[model samples]
Target: TYAETKFIEAEAEFLVANSGSFQATGANAAAYEAYLEGIRANMDKLGVSQADRDAYLSDPNVAVGTANLTMELIMKEKYKALFLNPETFNDLRRYNFDDTIFRGLELPEDHNSVLNGQWIQRAVYPSSEFSRNEDQVRQAEKAIDQPMWFYN
Candidate 1:
């Protein structure tokens, strides 16, 4: 939970720090540091080795404040650190699944239903809900592929 807070704070700091170029600046290094701190916190929780953590942080791709550091890099780290956590989808949605921001993330070759050639922005309410609260549920566009209320 603290990591989540830190990550959010990092994002805020990043937004303020890089208001134009959207690149890391020396003055913006605090957000960059906070971002790395988030990853370190997750590593600490997962019992990752100090050596491995050092190695990971050393890699140019994973290093903070380098040219390689961008919104995608931050989100990708968050994705890895929060794997299987529901908040993962929140991150995806907040960024609108922009391929530029989530590089290397490809939709499945054999697409699943309800998400044909598109991001499954939101799932339709459960079928049971449709029956139990047809009027209320029907108000929500009635499409499984529809984006959620906030997305609209």
Candidate 2:
């Protein structure tokens, strides 16, 4: 929870600092520091050894720099720290639903039949409900393969 909050704070600070307004963080460096702190909090929570965390952070790909900081890097680390959580799907939606941000994700070969090749957005309405409420279901057009109405 702290890690998530820190990541949000980092992103917010970075955006604010870059916007030319009064820097809420007072300096651009604070944004980068917050990002690193978020990742460190995650690493600590995940039981990564201090030595390993230091090594990983030094790997250039993971350690952030003021010049090198990008939304992609922040989202990638946020995604990693959020592994196995259902909210990750919502993050994908929020971030343009791109699989590239999640480097390891591979869509199942035998995907949901209704989805065909499109990304799944919502679960199918129950078959039992469909029979009892066919008219409502038809009007709702609760397509399993399409995004929810709000997203649309």
Q: In terms of TM-score, which candidate is strongest?
A: 1
- Cα TM-score per model: 0.77, 0.67
Q: Which stretches of candidate 2 lie over 4 Å from their true place?
A: 13-30, 124-141, 148-152
TM-score of 1: 0.77
What is candidate 1's lDDT per residue for 77-126, written digit by digit as tens?
77877789988887777666777768877888877765668877765577
Model 2 error, position 139 (Å): 9.5
Residue range 1-152, candidate 2, lDDT tens digits: 88887877777776777673322223367767887888899999989999999999888886647766765676678878888887777766654455554555566899877667777776567899788998998788756666653431
The lowest-lDDT stretch of 10 consecutive residues in candidate 2 is 20-29
Q: List candidate 1 stretches off by more than 4 Å.
A: 20-27, 66-68, 113-116, 149-152
